[model samples]
Structure formats: C-alpha cells, structure tokens
Target: MPPVKIVTDSTADLPEELYQRFGISRVPLKVLIESQIYRDGIDITPDEFYTQLRQGKLASTSQPAPGEFASMFEELTKDGSSALCLTLSSQFSGTCQSARLAANMIKEKARVDVIDTRSATWGVGLMAIAACRALSQGKNHDEVKELVDSLILKMRISFLVDSLDYLERGGRIGKAQAFLGSLLSVKPLLSVKDGIVCPTQKVRGKNKGLERLVEIVEQEVGEAPIICAILAGADPEARDILHQKAKERLNCQEIWLGDVGPVIGSHVGPGACGIIYYSL
Candidate 1:
C-alpha cells in the first residue's frame, strides 16, 4: 500500500508550512462576503476577511461541497493508501457531515474515515499536528487514529471574542446571546462543550477577558506538558499576550501561533485570541 495520507479541512487553522512539511491535504471551505464567494484560506485570507467585515460587509460561510472532499480522497487514495479526515466540531458547521458523505461516495473504491474533532480553531489544528507527527514517525492510519482519539480527550479549548455581533449573524449565538444585552460591550468567553459552543464568562473589558482566558487555561491544563496553539483573529496584542503567557505558565513541548481564518473569524469577529492545548 502507499503511505497513509492525512486530511483535514481549512478550519483547522494550521499554517502552510506544517501542511507542506507533514504531507497533510487541506480542503478549503467556502466563504461568502457581500455575496462574493471565496475559498476559506485560498482566495480570501484572515486579514482580507476581517477588513471586509469591518467595512460594513456581511460575511457568512458554507461547508465544502461533497465533491470538494471526495475528489481529494480519490486522488490521495489512488495508490491504495487509506486516509483519515479530521474535521471541526459538527455543531459548528456541516463540514464534518459533508466529509462523511464524501467518504461514503468513495467507500467502494478507497478507505476514508471521517472523524469529528469536537472542537474548532486551534483545537482542531493541534489535533492535525499530532496526527502529522505520528504519521511522520511511521504510524499507520489505525495507529494515528488511536493517537488522535487520545489527544482529543486531553484537548482543552477556550476563547474570548471582542463582540457577539458576528456570532449572532452566524446564528451560533447559543447562550452567548445573554451577553448581547450588555449593550455590545461585554467581552465574551466561549468554549466547546459536548461539541457545541457555549458561553463561559463575560467580562467588561478586553484585557480582563483575556486575563480570564489565560487563567482558565492555567486551571484546566495545570502543570502538564502540552502542545499548544495560540489562535488570533487579526489581533496582535491578544495573540502576543496569549503566546507569552502560555510559554511562561505552561510546560510546553510545542507551540503554534496563527490567525484564526474565516471559518472561526466569521463567528468570533476580530480582536480575539485564545489557546488550545493537549497535554502529552
């Protein structure tokens, strides 16, 4: 059989270097801004997406077409190798379900297993990195699947959004809608629980919200050695603080810092940053 292939959606938020270095194939999700369509990370970037959003444009996102994933699996598995499709939380998007349907459409020919990461943004990115690390070290699909499953249990993700308008527009407000009554000033802290977005805390100021985010990290991760990813939505100050504090406080084995692309940004809006760490 050919070497096992790793696959994930662009919502993972991993940098291009890692994708190239690890042989990971990423399928782009569709992003719509002002009725113009762009591939999540391809035609549009986080900077451009946010810039457009701030300019009074309405933004929305769509799941990848089933062909978007099936064609890639067909290409990657033509040599008889299997693939594992890791996706963002199903609650966040239909991408995971789309991937599963894609797998079904190709099952008579190639082996492709679709898994919901039950997380998003840096959380999904961290999972992809761990899978890449395993695959690079000669792990087979089954072996890496076990590794990823274990990593998921240890995964912890949380973030602070600058405002709730994006979430509201995206119809993912959940319990975060309670914060909107704060007159658009409450900085909301959110996390994935049971694979759905839920409000965690609401702070009155940006700095205070970020501090609470880091504190929540410290409490959850506590002294374990972890591989961490810092997610930013075009916010340098928040990213720098989260990165520095993660390094300072956590026993870190590896750290990844990148902007949360359109998938997450379309919901969180700009000026947001947070952490995703899996204890090794």
Candidate 2:
C-alpha cells in the first residue's frame, strides 16, 4: 500500500509537535484583531490570543483563502502522495468548503479526500488522529475514510461558556437572549449532534454548569477511552478542575487538557470549558 498523508486545519487544536510526529499538514485560519490580521496558531500563540480576549480586545476569525489552500495542497501532493484532509464543521466555518475546492483543483495531479469533521478543536483533532491510526494499519484511502466515518459517529462534544456575550457577538446567539440569560446568571450548555450545535440545557453559575457537563458526558458516553478537556483564557484553576473531573467520570485511558486557542477562544470567550471524546 502507498503511504497516506493526514491533513487538517488549525482549528483541530492539536499541539504543534504532534503535526510533525504524525506527518500532519495544516492550513491556518486568520484571526483578526481590529484592523490587523494574524494566522491562527502559526502567527500567534493561543496564550497571546486569550490574553487579548481577556483584556476586552475583540478578535474575530477568518478561514484561509483559496490560494492558500491551493498552495498547501500543491506542496503536500507534489511527491504524489495520497491525502486525507479533515476540516472544521461547515456549520461553524467555510474552511471545509475551501479545502474541497482546493482538492478539486488538484484532483488531476493527486488523490485527495476531504471530510467535514463537523467539529472543532480536538472534536476534529481526534478524527484526524484516528485517520492516522487507520493509515498506519495499512488501510487504503477509501477504506480509511469509511473507518473514520464509523468512529466519527460515536464522537461527541459539549461546551460550557462563562458568558453568552461572545456567542452573541459571533451571531450564534441573539442579543436579546444574551441579555436575558446574563441577567438570570444562566450558563448555557450546548452539544454537537450530527454536526450541529444545539442547546442541551442551561444552568446557573459556573460550578453547576461544569457538573452538568460531566453528568451529560457520563450518561451518554459511559466510559469513553480518549477524553479531552480544554479551557479558554488563562485560568489554571478551571483547567485543573476539568482535568480531575474528566478522569473520574469518563475513566478515560488518556485524557488531554488543552488550552483553547484564538480561533475558538475568540468565539467561546474567557472561562469557556468543554470536553470531546469517544467511547472505546
């Protein structure tokens, strides 16, 4: 079997070193702070982006241009490699569409398969990793995509936002709802099902919100193997709490605690925390 390459967008939120280790090629999204724009993860670190966010500096994100995607596809496929490109949820961004367009442009030269992960951060990151695992097992491109589809079916993600302000600003929520929810000290808990974000429930206060998140994970997942908990902003205490709860409730074989980066942090806002995992 020929070697297969794993390609993904920066929104996967996997660490930098893992990309090289796993032979993962990434296309960066743009983060706009006022008039200036920076590349996600590559041009700016997650820490820096979160600092700006916490300081009340509003930042917005943009997907890569067609040319950028074309360039990346050209470089990676220049050696006649077969590629699998995993992308952010189409519901959230147009990155997946851009990737597909680039792949179409290069189809004559190389075999490139693009998939919409219907997730962000490790929600999609785990799917990319699973593809690498399939390729390592000597699966062909078509077979690998089929196997990935199965794994993705069991994947789940849920989030707890500290405030609805950022979501409202991002147009994910209505301003009227945000105001009413804030006044009531309501923390909205959302879930990703079939690639769409749906409000599962709402609770009062951060503690109750976190507990509710863990409970939902426990009930639905019931001892998933790979679990990831991510925290936005610079709150060490919140990260630690999430890490501990994940270990206890999920009994995850490997639990990763990640810092939510600029691309996602900007929309989720400070004190946003969440988990994404799959059952073994």
Candidate 3:
C-alpha cells in the first residue's frame, strides 16, 4: 500500500510547510468578514484577519461543504493511497460531520477513515502529526487510525481570549457563560472540555491572563514528554514568551509555533493565544 495520507481542516492550524513536506491534505474553512467570504489560511492570513478585525469588521466561519471533502478524498486516494482525516470538534463546528459525509460519498469508501478528534487548532493538528509519523513508520491504514484514536483523548487545549464577544456570538461559550455576567473588562481563560469549549478562569488584563494560561498548561502536562504547539491569533509577541516559558517549565520534547487560522480567529478575535499538547 502507498503511504496513508493525513488530512485535516484549516482550523487545525498545522503549518503550511509541514503540509507540503508531509503530503498532508488541508481542507480550508470559510471566514465571513462583513459580507465577504474568504478561505481560511488561503485568502486571508492571521495578521490580515486581525488587521481587519481591528479595523471594526466582524467575522463568522462556516464548515466546508460535503462536496469539498469528497473532492479531497478522491484526490488523496487517486494514486492508490488511503487517507486518515482528523477534523475539528463536531461540537464546535460541522467540519467532522462534513468529512464523514464526504467519506461515504467517495467511490473508494473503505480507503479512508474520518475521525472527530473533539479538539481544535493544534489539538486536532497534533493527531494528524501523529498519523504522519505512523505512516512514515510503514504502518497501514488501520494501525494509523488506532494511533490517532488514542492520541485524541490525551490531547488538551487551553486558551485565553482578549474578549468574550466572539465566543458569546458563536454560542460555544458552554461553561464559560459565567464570564458573561461580569464586567466586560475581564479577560477569560478557556479550555476545550468533553468536546465543548468552557471557561477556566478570569483575570483583569492581558499579561495576567497569559500568565494564568502558562500556569494552566504547566499543570496539565506536568513533566510529561508530550509534543506541544502554541497558536496565536495575532499576538505572537505574547505567544512567543508563553512558548519559551512552557518549554522551560513543562520539559516538552518538541514544540510547534503557528497562527490560529482565520476561521478560529474570527470567533476568538485578535489577541487570542493558546497551547495544545498530547503524549503520543
């Protein structure tokens, strides 16, 4: 069998260079700014998205249509290779549902497996990275699927948003709903729990929120050798510091730094940063 190809959505925030180097398939999501629609990571970059947001344009995102994934599956397996598509949480977006729908729509249905990772951003991307590693090790489709399945549960995502406006509008606030009743000036620390985004804590300002975020990550990984990634909306300066502190504090084996895609950035807005990691 040819190597099992890895697939993911734009919200995974996996670096583009890795996509080309590893032959990973990324299906872009839609980001709507005002009345304009842009493909995440393609038409609009993180810096561009944040610039527009700061300029007073509100944005929204949509999952890829089933036809998009169907086309991707056909292209990935055209040369006798199978595909393993790890997608964003179904609870957050319908991207996983679209992937599953596309899998059945394909002619070679058994040549692919669509998994709902129940994580977003690098949390979902980390599973794809693990699948790529397994594929490179000569593992077959089923073996790679098993590896990804285990990695999903071990993964964790924790973030601090500069504002709650986006989360409130998206209705993904979940347990974070408590933050809404408070003063609008408070920054929120959030986490993806049981497939839903929830609030973890609150602080007065940006620096304090970032400090709490690093502390949350250190507590979650706790000396484990998990591979880690830091994703920023438009706040690389703060994210870089968090990355260095995390590396020094958690003793992570490897770390990846990338921007949050436009779709996610739309909901989180600018000044959002987070960490996702797993021990696979």
What are the TM-scores, per candidate, against the unseen true structure?
0.96, 0.93, 0.95
User: In model 2, which residue pairs have backbone atoms overlapping below 3 Å?
Assistant: none
Give the per-residue lDDT digits (tens) of candidate 1, residues 52-121. 8788788888999899999999999999989998999898889999999999999999889998988887
Task: Report the candidate with higher TM-score, 2 versus 3.
Answer: 3
- List, residue by residue over 62-150, the lDDT tens digit for candidate 2: 99877788788888878877888888888888899999999898889988888888777888888887788878878888988897778
Better of 1 and 2 by lDDT: 1
Q: Which segments of model 3 are wrong by more than 4 Å?
A: 107-110
Query: Lowest lDDT 10-mer window, candidate 3?
Result: 104-113
What are the C-alpha RMSDs, in order, of all predicted structures? 1.4, 2.2, 1.5
Model 3 compared with the native: what TM-score? 0.95
Candidate 1 TM-score versus the reference? 0.96
When sorted by TM-score, best at the front, the candidate numbers are 1, 3, 2
Clashing residue pairs found in predicted model 3: none
